[model samples]
Target: MPSFLRWIACRAMLAACLAGIAASARAGCEPLTEDGHDYVACRFDPRSDALSLYWRGADGMPLATTERLADAVAATGRKLVFAMNAGMYDTALAPIGLYVENGRMLHRANLRNGAGNFHLKPNGVFYFGDGKAGVMETGRFLKARLNPAFATQSGPMLVIDGQIHPKLQPDGASEKVRNGVGVRDDGTVVFAISTEPVSFYAFARLFRDRLGTQNALFLDGSISTLYAPPLPPVGGWRSLGPMLGVTAGP
Candidate 1:
């Protein structure tokens, strides 16, 4: 099919998936397309879905892989239905920026200027608590002075206040499998991963345009991975830093 045709078809699919979706949403993924790029979006609500973040296991080591996380949660009589790499990490697999899990601040916000995607100015944080979620630029988030139950800091925000990152090119040459998160106006959290390699601008637009999120944060590239099965590999992921997922009790 022509690229435009495919894009149209995928938009229709996304609309159908979102129709009637609310706090009742389950951990299910749907195919989406934006400006000819293919993506898979999985949505859930912390109000009803067991949306949460994970880092260490019972043994106090990073749970690194989705497969391993699934095993660990299962042992606790829970079902892990959704997961994705949460943010960039160091060689030791520690989140490079602020990381809060279960209302506990495990790491502090990173404000030092440095190289790489994480240092992209206006990097933001995705946070949730009390059944509410939001995406905010790291600076603004700090000024807000609100503490959330769970939050992860990631770089080069895809969208801010409804605008794409000022630095990304609409048709940039760089392309790779990418994933990110956004919060819809209704406080519903959406996680997405590009099915095919895509540019940063394209991926960012997927959240703002098609997904209707006011703000979005780029989680990672190439290493981006979504744990929605039956979907494609998404990308290679292991030794990942903080991770987010949805679970259900047995």
Candidate 2:
């Protein structure tokens, strides 16, 4: 081939490669409804989208709201794209179970059983590092002894190894606003929250059936909320504990 023709072909290939990368990195949220309940579902590529866990601010207090987190991230020259309350917490806005951020372990994993969702047996941790993400039962996580760059321990895994939690009932009377995270087969991280109250069984189905995730961990309920852009901010009276957020790439 002529030199001129070879140069044009090389440029075309480079352009195509760049386009594929952009498509894989795209992230956003959308409204969804299931089982008569409303929800907001956001999908992101863990390998590309910038995912981070945040707790305390520079003032040594939890960044309770999305606005505060956004400002903090903005100061670092990156825009906060979306955020959601992650894991269960105590009255003082501290994570009830294991919480790790940027290699720092703020809280230790709780293995005992007690009241509330956090203590729900078989509670799991959602963790990510080295361009990979996953959800594992707390017991399994402890056994593996893997150290992640970011992690949050939350409970009563909605979907465990492709099976729904044994305690969840199809017609359970309990229902409340809930949010959770799941990793798809292709390494996409999906964050979903019920805009309206929903039962644990129903919410679990959303991850296993709708999202096709084999493992999903419930983040929180009642006060579960999300902060996705373009849609008005969602907030609650209770202050958040640990938060998971996605920020604009550098």
Candidate 3:
């Protein structure tokens, strides 16, 4: 075989190996700082793990904690490997917008013109089904009619089509511990939470520039929470609204 041909084959093999690693990336959450702000991020491939959304459990009450969610998952012969507050909620712990779990649309998409980050124009949804997942602007999602098995709606998209949300200012004053989710070009889902108060601009940049996601949505702020065993726990409120998580076989 020609030397050039052998080199091409080696490069292809290396690409394949890298893809496999990304496809099964559940090693742990990573902590890092970008532009003077600190954050912890985790990546997972929906195609490889059974990613689902949860609200009320078998007892007809919300599973309000990681331990409870874990128990619920264990009941089905699975282990809760990852969990995160998926969206903003009202006073009664109800999703402010669309919330679909296990193919049931509990809360239809809230299209009313209102206030808060959730009502911010261009809010988006994070949804997945079968072997694929995506983050898309709510309008686009509604038009697409993807009908994902599990979906959660949140506001003020961080990044769209590789560009940061137009309204987020680079030096915006408001800042708080925040978390959001994004979908990579390869269909990998990335979740990130700022370790400290960070402006919406920086957070959006974290997803667009650092994470390389074409579309990303801001899940929540201040009450942003995550529960990946590999990393430390984070929950601003006693209980969260819609929860998104991954499960591993028991």
Q: What is the TM-score of candidate 3?
A: 0.88
Q: Which runs in model 1 stand beyond 4 Å of their true positions?
A: 1-25, 230-232
Model 3 C-alpha lDDT per residue in residues 127-243, reported as the tens digit of each score: 998989999899899999788888899999999999999999988999999999999999989999998999999999999899889999999999888787767887646687778
Evaluated at residue 201, the lDDT of candidate 2 is 96
Question: What's the lDDT for residue 204 in model 1?
Answer: 87
Q: How accurate locally, in lDDT, is each candidate?
A: 0.86, 0.87, 0.87
In Å, residue 161's CA in model 3 sits off its true spot by 0.6
TM-score leader: 2
lDDT of 1 by residue, 39-153 (tens): 8998877687788899888999999999889999899998776789999888888999999999999999999999988998889999998988999999999999989999999
Off by over 4 Å in 2: 1-26, 236-238
Number of backbone clashes in candidate 2: 0
> What ranges in model 3 sit over 4 Å off?
1-27
Return the clash pairs for model 2, or none.
none
Q: State candidate 1's TM-score.
A: 0.88
- Sort all candidates by TM-score, best to worst: 2, 3, 1
Question: Which one wins on lDDT?
Answer: 2
Angstrom error at residue 213, model 1: 0.3
